[model samples]
Structure formats: C-alpha cells, structure tokens
Target: MAESPFAWIDEQARARRRAGLVRTLRPRPADTPLLDLASNDYLGLARHPEITEAAARAARVWGGGATGSRLVTGSTELHAELERELAEFCGFESALVFSSGYAANLAAVTALAPHGSLIVSDAGNHASLIDGCRLARGATQVVAHADPEAVRKALGTHSGPAVVVSDTVFSVDGDAAPLTGLAGVCRESGAGLVVDDAHGLGVLGEGGRGAPHAAGLAGAADVVATVTLSKSFGSQGGAVLGPARVIEHLVNAARTFIFDTGLAPAAAGAALAALRLLRREPERAARARAVATELHTRLTAEGLEAVRPDAAVVSVRAPSPEQAVRWAADCREAGLAVGCFRPPSVPDGISRLRLTARADLTGGQIDRAVRVISEARR
Candidate 1:
C-alpha cells in the first residue's frame, strides 16, 4: 500500500487537541439574541441604516464587484472619491485603498523597503506587518515592544534607508505604542515611520482622526499609516495613507495593489458613508473609548485581571488556555458573546478573554456584560 501522505495532519491535530489549542468557527445567525462584545464594530456603524443603504445603493449602481485589478479596469470614480475623503479625514496628503488591511500593509512595507534598506519592526506588531517585513527585500530587525530606544539603536546600526514599523495600539493587550517617542527617534535617525492603525482608526485621536494624526505625524513627509475599514468604519477594506509621492510609488511598485483585485463597491460605499457619519458624530469616538474604560474598570473591580485599554479593546487574563475557552463558552451560554485568545494569537503565550467596546452599547448592556463575564470566570 502507498504511504499516507496526509497522515501528519492527524498527528498535528492530536497535538493541538492535547494542548487545548483547537480552533473552531461558529457561524452567526442573522438575528442573534446574544449581546456582542467579540466584534470589531467599535463605533456601532456596521448595521446603521444609512451605511447599509449606501452599500445597497453602491451595489445597484456599480454592480457586485470591482471586476479587475485596480490598474486594469477596477479604478472607479467611487474608489477615487473614497480615497480622497479618507486621506482628508486622516490628515494624510494622499491615500490608496486595497482589498484588505493585510494587503495594504504588504504593499506599503514591500514597496517602501526595497533592497539594501532596513526595516526596524516592533516585536508586538500585527502579523500582517511581520509578513510584510518578511516579504520585503530589506533587512528586518525586530526590536522590543513599544521601545523607542531599541528602535533607535537598531536604526543606528543601519547606514541605509530605514523604516520603523509598529501597531498604533496592539490588538492582543490593547496597549498603545509609544508613538511620540518612536516618531522622535525616527526623525533623529532620518528614518521613515510606518504605523498600522488597525485598532486606532475609530477609537483614538481627536474625533478618531487616528493615532498618527494625534501624534502630530499625520501629513508628515516621512510617516505612513495603514488602516482597516472593517473595524470602526463597519466595512470591508484597507488603505495606505502617506505623502502623495509614496502613494504614487505604491501605485507603481506595490505588487499587492498592482496584482490584487480592487475593493468591492459595496464596501467602498459603506466605508465612505461611515466616514461621513463619523465626521458628523465625532462624539462616537470618545464614547467607544469610554465604554472600553468602563469595561476595564468593572472587570478589574470584580478582581479580574484586565489590561487597561487604550482604545476599544479590553483584554482579561485567563489562567490557562482550557479555562479561557471554557470561560468564553460559559459567557456564550449566558447570552453574552466575547472573544477568546490563546497561544498562537497571543504573543506572550498567555490566554485571554478579549472584549470589544461598542459605542452603541447602553449602560445596562455594559453592566450585564460585566456580570456575565464575572460569572463565567473560573
């Protein structure tokens, strides 16, 4: 008999099961009764009537898909409009939209860090950024998490074009990067700074202008930022915001942008609508942050160890991976949905119950969520 080529997968599966790291997906229903704290809809705009109507209107007018890569036949007038508005809102000189945030990061890093250059990446950066560094032609050196001094030291050793990459707010622990410090070091070293604001787009800065803007790096010649529309915008896409020259470079050299299909029209429309709505209701940004603070305060008051959130994410430390999974299940049983983070997802190898704070959540909802989480803790 021929050898079983796929036999290793079973062994890996068994190991994962023994380690309590097995992952499974649960499809959500259209009308779920459970209160949601697992989603990234920080501003509660995903289901807003106006946003949905915009999506519908876009689909009616632009059809279902972009139909080609951006340069080929997919660059619609709507895309250009969204790009202009996004750049303006984020305080960047220009912007380019991608199919997703991951693609945007890949495009930015790989395009910016060419051969003989250096990429000083923070240890706690998102996987997308890490992958971008890996894919880029430059030499990459990862420094301590949120440590500007480490980045400075690394940049000092490289006598070439260099860029420092980090997340504005780390997703795992919900802690913010030292953006001001990092930016200062980058300026001193004559290095460009690239930040991923996936968690900061609608939860940080004045009126959610974003972390880079809040750090006064927005529209800076050497600063570039990437953001996801899926989170606060309640849509599906990503974009790179930077100087017009950088945007032009990516348009010409970024493989992801050049090769990948353009963002869907509905997502573009929905994101534009959300951006306009956010501009009108800037208070939504502060509300999301307040909700996160409240969640952290209440959880810690109940003796649950939670990292203080800088944005809308609240992470509660769990004793173990098994306990974390069981706790999340228990919370689900109690009609509250929360996120569970384990080994591979958490850089520190610590398990956690990740909770998201939505601007639309009421006081009663917050109280109930805290109670349920407390009851579910082992």
Candidate 2:
C-alpha cells in the first residue's frame, strides 16, 4: 500500500506507449505555416480579423478571465446577450452557455436523466457524449449507429423517463443521424430527444441554424440541443438550448453551468460577433458544407475510401491506426496538416484521416490538399 497511491500510473503509460496511443500536447507557434485541414473552425472564422479584434477588445474591457463561477460573479451582460441571440438564432426558447462543449454535454445528460431514468445513446457519438452517458445517473442503452429501429426497441424495453441522446452529425465519419426518424421514435415512447449539434450549427440548415432546426425540432418541447462555439463560432465555449422550462431547470440543476466559471468575455464577444456575421452572410454555412462535399468527392474519385460528408467534416478510411498516423505525418511533412483518428476516438474500431473543410479554402488549396492526401496513403 503506497502512500502516494500513484504507483501503477507508469505501467499504464508504458502500455499506452507500446500501443502507440500515448497522446501529448504539441505547442504550436503563432507563425507555424502548415496548411490546416485538422482544425474544427469550419467557417474559417477563428483567426478572422474581426473576430480576433473583438476578442482583444473584450479582454481589455472585461479582464482576462471570468472572475468567479457563473452562479456567483461570472455572469455578465455579454453572456446574457449571447445566450439570447444563440437561442433565437437556433430557434430555441432559451439557451445556457457553459465553459466547453464537453461540459455542456455533461450538464445536459446528467441534469436531464434522473436516478431511475433511461438514456438511449448512439454508438457513434463523440467521446464527450459517451463520457456524459457514463456520468449520467440513469442507465444508458447504447443503440446502433443512426438506427431508429434500434432506438425504438430500446425505448420499448424501458417504461420510465427516457432520453435519446445523439450527435446530430457523427463526428468521426461525418455522417448525419436520422434526426427526423429518431424524433419520431422518441415521440411514440414519450421520451425526450437530446441532440449534440456540435457539428451541425454553422455547418447545417439554412444559415446554419443547426440540425434541430432543419429537422423542425428546434423549439419542440420534447427536444433539447447542445452546440459548441469552438467549431463554427471560432470561439471557446458550449451551450445547451431548449424550452424555457428546460433551460430554467439547467440553470438551477446543471452542475457544470452553476459550478464552472462562465465562458470568458473574450470568447463570448467573439462568438457573438461571429453569430452576427453569419446572420448577415449566411452563405458561409453553405460554403462549409459545399467544401466538405467537394473534398469527399475528390478523395473518392482519387480512389480513397472517404465518407460522404453530411457537414464540414470529411473522413477517409486508412488501413490501420499506425498507417493512419503515418499518413497524417506525411501530409504534415508535405505542408498539409490533417487529423488522424484511431481507436478509441473511432468507436467502430476503424482508423481514419479526418479532414475539416474550411469555408474559406480556395480551389487551388483544395486541389493541393487532395493531391497531398492521396499521395500520403499507405
């Protein structure tokens, strides 16, 4: 019995290293010049001059960080304004912002599912959602990926308060869930449907209102949605949106929202600016989807096993995890930075090279990226 209680950590680390799964943070320089296809800034707004400027101004005006927990001193007019605009933009009755999309998912899943409730989750959801399910108080049934029938069957077995949780668009494969079908299944079971629209907002629907809006479930009393500002808003936060009553419940009951510091003023300001920009120039959202489609088409034509995108993400299968990692490394060497997804990021036990399509990419950039990717395959 070691007093430190950390003696086994080294063994696990060595095991992870041998498995080629040890992850480390690499500090990126401001002037690093790799062509990015890995970042989630689908709208290409993360480094936009206006967005950065707004962030700078906010930090100067409101200080460098949120001073306290949102329930205490962290809530500000900026947060309130962003919440209002986000809810209205996405057609929800109310919205509550959290520190990150991960936190938002945790809050939503835990707050909505009570001790005796049931949670029906999709197998292909993001890791955050999967973790949220694990943290939830209710018993969770992981249904098959995007199978409404599976959802129905799971709900049939449970006769309590149930919630069907899924990502609007599967992150790894970039394939969309049958939201309409899932909603119908939930409707029959008297269950609420909770969607993590991380890859949908600012990349789906008219003006990127999100998949919930596209499926006509945005303001539905039985539906709740979560979104991330880091992806399309080019900011750093997440939100949960739903009926006013649901939001009220989250405000009081969601531990993440009440205990964590409010999203920084700079992020809130930048996200607000981006949202307004998107409202004014809605084509950014459409362009992102178009880029994703074109990338998939070109990759498939070049004899790659790329998944046809449902949003701004494009995933091409690789032979193995090591090969996938090497392929991505080669791409980086070729001045093209792309994402490499391996187990357990991919729930299907398949590895992939994940490419994010930026709305701002040019024709030449697309061609170059395609060439680089094709050449890097094992």
Candidate 3:
C-alpha cells in the first residue's frame, strides 16, 4: 500500500495526547441540568423569554439567515435600527454590524491599519484581535500586557499611521487593560486606539455602557471599539462602534464587511431586545459584577489560586494541563459546567479553570459553585 499523504496528522495527534492537550467537542443539549459557569452570557439573557421571542419574530419577518452581503442584498431596516441603538447606547457616533465578533475585529484592524501603519497590540489580547493584527497590512508590535508605558514606547518608534489595539477586559485572566492610560498615550502620539470590548459590554461601566465609556473614551473621535453580540447581548454577531467617519470608512473599505454576508436578522433582533432589557434592568450589570467578585473572593478564601476578576470571568489556576482538564471534568461530574483553558489557547501556557458569572445566579448557587469547585480541585 502507498504511504498516506496525510501521515503528519497522526503524528500531531500523538504529540497532543502526550502533552495532555487533546481537545474534543461536547455538544450540550437544549436543556442542561448542570449549573453553567462556562458561557459568556454575563447578563443571563441568552435564553430570556423576551430575547427568544424577538429572535423568533425576526426569523418570521426576515428569515433564518441573511440572504446576501450588506453591499448586495442583506441590509435591512432591522440592521440599521440595531446599529443606531448600539452606537447610542455605547456612546459612539455610529456603529456597523458584522457576521461575528471575529469578523468585526478583522475588519476594524485591517481597515484602519493600512500599509505603512503600525499596530501596537497588547500581549494578552484575545485571539480575534491577534488574528486581526496578523491579517492587517500594517506591522504589529506586541507590548507587555496592560502596560501603558510600553505602548507609548512602541508608538514612539513609529512615525506613520499607528493604532493601539487591546482588549478592554482580557479573556484569559479576566484582567482589565489600562484604557485611560492607553488613550492618553494614543492622544499624545496622535495615534488611534482600537479595543475589543467583548467581555466588558454587560459587566462594566455605568449600567454596562462598557470599559471605554467608563474610561471616558467612548465618544472620543480617536477611539474605536469592537464588541460581540453573542456575549452580553445574548445573540450571534459583532459590531464596530466609533466616530461616524471611521464607521463610514469601514463600510466602504473593510473586506470583511464588503464580502461576507450580513449578520442574521434574528441575531440582530435578539441583540436589540437584550439591549433594551439591559436598559430597563440596569441592575443586572451590577449583579453580574457582584457575582464575579463573590466567586473570586470565595475561591481565594478557600486557598485556591485565582485571578481577581475585573468583570464577570473568574480564572482559577491549575497545576498542569492534565490537572486542569481533570478538575473541569470532576466539576462537571459534580453538576457544574466550567471552562478549561489549556496550552495554545492560553498565551502564557498556563492552564486554568475559567468560570463565568451570570446575573441570574443566586447566592445559594454561588456558594454551591464555590463548594463544588473547591472540592473538585486536583
């Protein structure tokens, strides 16, 4: 028999197994019995009755998917309305929706950082932002995580068009970037600042206006933000919010926007509904933050090594990748669903159990989660 052309696949699989880094999908049923601490639904609106009804209504009115790209046939009145509300709520002059948050990041980075431009990215940004920097035409220099001085130094090295990119709230450690300091450096250097607020929208600022709004940069002309509807908004899509001119430029120049199909109508509708719900029930945001603080405090008090959450994510360290996986599995067996982060996913190569705090989680549930996690530690 001829040697298989894809023999390298088996070798890589073996390597992953040896390194305790093999990953597999575990599709969840519609009605899960386990207490969820793995999802990004910070406001607990993903399955809300109002959100579901809006999704159904939009599907009935618009269909299951967007028919075409925004430039072709997919721009609907619903999309326009969502954009308007998103911009206003986030204190931006305008907003542009995309098929996913990843797409939005790619669009914002690639469109803004043209040839000869320099992109100073934070070391601990989300993968989407990292990929965006890679895809952009400009050169990217990664600075130390959460260091404003490093950003300033990087900006000093370049004289052409430059933009500073970072996550408002990092996903792995749940640490927040110094947005005010970054903005100050950008202003001093005459560079634009682009941030991904995926983890901040429903958990930070006054009534969850987001990290940028909290830092007094939301409406600034020199700043732009990308956010995911799948998170706080409890839907499936992403958007770029900024000054009217920057958004207009993205609509005209961003390849992701020009070629990719528009965001689904149902997602747009559902996100809009969730936004309205957040507006009416602003306490949900505070509750989500409180839950995170309680989880971190409880876990740490129990002698667990965990990062102090800046938003709704709590990251607990594990001794090794194998131990992290086993810990997560044990927690799952004990009726808790937690996120397990391992090598390649974590930039620092540290494995940890990631827990997401939701607004709807009760005090009893929080205590139960803490107990389960403490008992399940490897």
Total clashing residue pairs per candidate? Answer: 0, 0, 0
Q: CA lDDT, every prediction?
A: 0.96, 0.93, 0.95
Candidate 1, residues 238-257, lDDT tens digits: the string is: 99999999999999999999
Ranking by lDDT: 1, 3, 2
Model 2 superposed RMSD (Cα): 1.4
After TM-score superposition, what is the CA distance of residue 124 in candidate 1 from its true location, in Å?
Answer: 0.7
- TM-score of each candidate structure, all chains considered together: 0.99, 0.97, 0.99
**What local lDDT score does residue 22 receive in model 1, on the 0 to 100 scale?**
100
* Candidate 3 per-residue lDDT over residues 1-378, each given as its tens digit: 988999989999999999999999999999999999999999989999999999999999999988999999889999999999999999999999999999999999999999999999999989889999999999999999999999999999999999999999999999999999999999998999999999999789989999999999998999999999999888999999999999999999999999999999999999999999999999999999999999999999999999999999999999999999999999999999999999899999999999999999999999999999999983
Runs off by more than 4 Å, candidate 1: none
Residue-by-residue lDDT tens digits, candidate 2, 199-231? 999999889999999999989999999999999
The 10-residue segment with the lowest total lDDT in model 3: 369-378
Worst ten-residue run, lDDT, model 1?
Answer: 369-378
